[model samples]
Target: MDTTETLQGILEFIDEHITDNISPEVLAAQAGYSTWHFCRLFQWGTGYSVMAYVRNRRLAFAAYELSSGKRILDISMDYGFGTHSGFSKAFRRYFGCSPGTYRLHAHSNRPFPPSLPGAYKYLIGGIIMEPKFVTLPAIKLAGFAIKTTSVAGENSKAIPAFWNDYMSNGMMEKLHAEKFIKKHDEYGVCFQEDMTTGEFEYVIGVERKDDAEISGEYHVCEVPPATYAVFSSPPSDGANFAAAIQGTWNYIFNEWFPKSGYEYAPNCNDFELYDDRSMPDEGKICDIYIPVVRMQK
Candidate 1:
């Protein structure tokens, strides 16, 4: 099903049940998506979380009722607030005035009701190839590791440089000599996020046999078996390499996932595969793997 179509269905549902208590879980189930995936998609598509969107829509209607001389407590309860006080606090925060004041003198300042745009548009252009779904068996990787914040753009600066450092300092040749090196191909592995703090470890390494001996700064990390959504980059010639790669990621998260009806499999690691077939400076060809599972309907 098209994501915009699914979203439109949800919007119709919301409009029909505006006065009813609505939660993320409720909407997600209605849309046949996992709660986490649904929340992210809702925010991306409409610029608000399910709860925030509902609150804003309700507040707009409540303000309209206030102008109609409806009782404050009735208006509050009608919008799913447990008490008048709770509604009033939220109202004041959102509108910068108490409901009473708004009703009496600030009718002109009522917030416009929230609406969803027909579709989210992307300004960047690229070929967004349909992903090949594959299951990766459990494996271990060993190589240089670095700590990075989950914050946007932090890893952007660090990762490319990490790759360069690894290549220039002879780390590649050193690892290739190990008996346990499973293959000549290299892996860029991202650890599962530590939710409590927005931090994760990024490792650039190669698959190694279980009994592989390791020495010095190199470390090992394990990956569990899982299905993946794999995206391929256009020939990453230096000129368009970064843009092409980043645009592919944008398409996956912004365009593909919402429509794919899949959620990231919890506790699975995501990784990039680069082998002799790739030319980081010239063709820069590589495959990106995202762990995923079908969302329970």
Candidate 2:
């Protein structure tokens, strides 16, 4: 088998024996490579060290089990975390919250299995578009804002409803009429997350002109300068536009990040830039800008 197939098999093996004691040496032996060589190959393939990947998978399963109403200690031990304290510490470091808190706002944020080249495609209609990297100046925006959470995928449901209301309630027309508006294009921006509650603020607004006067009713946000990997949704008509956009997002998080050598930049806003191309009769595409920083070695 080639390297891709070998790593895919190893990934499946890791998942199967997640709750058991799994060592790099054991996995190296399984892959028919020396431990030193296997370590390098595994990191190159998965962007995670051998044991780190195992630990993360274990924590993901542990997070899933938290909702089952099982005792925390039992769940920890089942994931091979020997002690509750050890589990809680590792859990906090990886997820930014303790087990109890994550359970209270439980949603599966598990890392999806990586898609090796030629194994599977995550885009809509099998269309693939590579992202372009760009560094942008600070941006200012003014519009409607809503508080949402990732818990139970609340943002997915809440954001669409929020948009529907904005469009139907005359808010969209009112915002565009403002003198402060820099462009007719709209932005759907997700601000940095709150680690404690898994909640964040999302804004649906247009770009604000630099010298424009502020309005009392509008929510304002300023995004600092950053480098971003920008991905465009596959071109689709009005009927399939939303699906196409969602598919690109899935591909970015599930298929790209693990192999991209970059992670989401902290304290920066990621947004969808919807311009004329996003109109029903136009290009029917939206650009997703994700701020990024090189992953630490």
Among these predictions, the greatest lDDT belongs to 2
TM-scores for the candidates: 0.61, 0.62
* Cα distance off (Å), candidate 2, residue 120: 6.8
Model 1: how far is 177 from its true place, Å? Answer: 2.9
RMSD of 1: 7.4
Which lDDT tens digits does candidate 2 get at residues 107-184? 675545656775544457776567999999998889999998654457778999999999999999999988898878
Question: Candidate 1: which stretches are off by over 4 Å?
Answer: 1-126
lDDT of 1 by residue, 1-297 (tens): 666677778877886788987877889899887766676566545545577667777887788889887899999999998899999998997788999999888664444434555554442444557999998789788888988743334567788888889989998888888887878788998785443233568999888877867776688888899999998767767777667666666567667887677887877777888877576577677787888988776
* Top model number, TM-score: 2
Give the range where candidate 2 is weakest over 10 consecutive residues by summed lDDT. 35-44
The 0-to-1 C-alpha lDDT of every candidate, in the order given, reads 0.75, 0.81
Q: Lowest-scoring 10 consecutive residues by lDDT in candidate 1? A: 119-128
Colliding residue pairs in candidate 2: none
